[model samples]
Target: MVIRISKGSILILCLVLTNCKDSNKKLKETTVVSNIEKTLNFNLESAIADCQTQLERAVPKLTDLTKHPRFIEKEDTDWHQVPNDKLMWTSGFYPGILWYAYDVTGDNKWKKEAIKRTEVFEDFKNITEHHDIGFMMFPAYGNGFKIGDKKEYKDILLTSANSLATRFNPNVGTIKSWSNKMHPRWKQHITIIDNMLNLELLFWSAKNGGNPVHYDMAVKHAETTMNNHFREDLTSWHVIEYDSINGKVLNRHTKQGFADDSRWSRGQAWGVYGYTMVYKETKDKKFLDFAKKLADKYISLLPEDMIPAWDFDVQSDPKEEKDASAAAVVASALIDLSSFVESKEEQVKYLNAGIKMLNSLSSKKYSGVGKSDAFLLHSTGAKSLGWEIDVALIYADYYYIEALSRLKKLEKK
Candidate 1:
């Protein structure tokens, strides 16, 4: 070894060593990328772990909220503020989380809590004519059925579906947005794309409960929404007009957007996810095509970190008030849509985009360490409604898990 020799030989040896080091570095980088891809592909074990930790921390807070129950009066965190009695709708979302918690940890405590929480709503009929019955009912009861195979949960879901069906106005071709009890004169009005989320439960109800009318009505509402709610750019409006008595398009309005003409961020997200879900259920090419188009528009506008501003078209400097919930919703729905795409490239595009958004969220800013709340991050509510700057909302948590579940399922397959 000591006989080494000329400078040329030494130079050659140095070059080889450097080359090997460079190759190793490159290999490490590639491995990191692969791990990220695996994370995106959906690892249920990890997702379940994250979900359980969040749930365990959040449950005590929920239990505290119900110490005294009343309509929209039950005390909750600042962001998730709703009446105790009316908050029963949110109770639906919790069981699914609880179920997830139970499923992941095999914890009897989670199972008991889920069952007890669901039992509270066993006779809890009388759904308010809000735009989120699906959120209210499906998470609480629909998921409850999935978790435990309870007939009562199934029955309540069907009943809620029936109530939702009644809210449908044949004239508007959409479900009336809200019950007039909150506003005497607006007895039957069509507004909000949020209802589209709830309509899927109606489809489920029809299929599971033998009511074709419910499925038909859900499709009608979805069709009505796609035609009227979406703007040319695939942006969406929060309010629209429908001849409630005749099911005809009256006009498009913007009650919730920044202006009657501005594109609201959450509303756009609602449209993207809703139509995508509709496409999944109905296999309607129009809906799927529209979903892809809107998704493209949405992804194009995303900020550097992938979280969207509360309103995409808002001219003000980007605000942290941006909705993380929207990203979660879109990601979860995109995963669902991925299965329907025949092209592997197309599937990867949608799924990868979603994974990027979720990973960005899980990083420092969106999901802080020891946050203790079940929420992932980013939720904003109407200031006039006294819910501005709400964080870690229930819906955000729900969809975040949903996205996680979809990703995890893909990995297994």
Candidate 2:
């Protein structure tokens, strides 16, 4: 297949080249790619080929020859791209999936597609309204930096970290997750369990520039979340409403889960992934222990196939929609956490658990192979709200690919 880059994309290419430091600019522009063998002993060559075909099919539908994909809009059961701006939290994962594909398959096709998609986010580095800049920047630009060694990636990520840091209210001891335009049920200062995952962007910024405040704020937010977000049973509240003025805990409720008290399966995944990631970056034992408890609870609660219903308390039917995205996140976190455990038994337990989740996701029923949807399957995105339910969420695809990449690296050890 011929590589297609329009004349307009050439401008984006030049801008991408010039934005970063000249000395640090490196792009591995190569068409030859050797296939990477999966170390988890999972045969993903066929699956990845399916992903490549779907993505290639998806590219022709682009209205803007320059910009890459937004999330697929479901017209009934079919998924197709509808244009949207960069105001969404899942924006980065599209390019992120491409980057991971590049890393795993060494395919220049994925790299080129990823770079084009990444260029669209150049203006978003300065956005500060929400705490999701990390979600928007890091996986796309961060992977670009890692793959290409571009100074542009570093600069954008640092700026995004600063943008994320701006949301940190010291009085509340946490970063506000949403803008004021969120659901009216939320307080002005609502710190969510998912925000725990964004601290990595701040921590990355602090490490590179020696910014002490970024580090301090991330630590404080983790502490605050540790103190407030969890139930006694170790599951998480989706959102914790706070008094913005005095840092008082006003009420703990959910904006995304099934009910105020129901366990949102994805939120549980965030708790495990975020705490595990924070612990990985900080070496904080408390966070690691906390992550373990949440992961264990999640594992114990999983239905026989290891897939979780969107919310544990919301659905009783075995056929209810499941959040495979959350399952993927937990699988990726467990893979990382396995490396950190002191006990060999626990390590094997976590590792095997991750492999089990991956096996489930990769199965024919859920993998969405040869499906017209053009994304992975069995992902329940806010099923209770009737939004993106039982669809292939891009974030789920990102973390699923990420898990495979992490597994590939670990298998080498």
Give the per-residue lDDT digits (tens) of candidate 1, residues 1-413: 57758999999999999999998865654453346578766344665676777666656666653432111211233234445464334556666666656654668898788777766655445665565566666776776677566666677788778777777777677777765575453444766777788888888888896478988898888887778777777787777766656656656655445666777777778877888888888888988998888888888888887787766766257543677778888888877777677675677677778878877767657762365364465565442244545456566666777777666656544
Q: In model 1, which runs have C-alpha deviations exceeding 4 angstroms? A: 1-47, 64-82, 87-89, 103-108, 181-188, 383-386
Candidate No. with top TM-score: 2
TM-score of each: 0.81, 0.85
- Angstrom error of the Cα, residue 263, model 1: value is 1.6
User: How many residue pairs clash (N, CA or C atoms closer than 3 angstroms) in each of the candidate models, in the order given?
Assistant: 14, 0
RMSD of each: 10.5, 13.1
Question: Which ten contiguous residues of candidate 1 have the minimum total lDDT?
Answer: 68-77
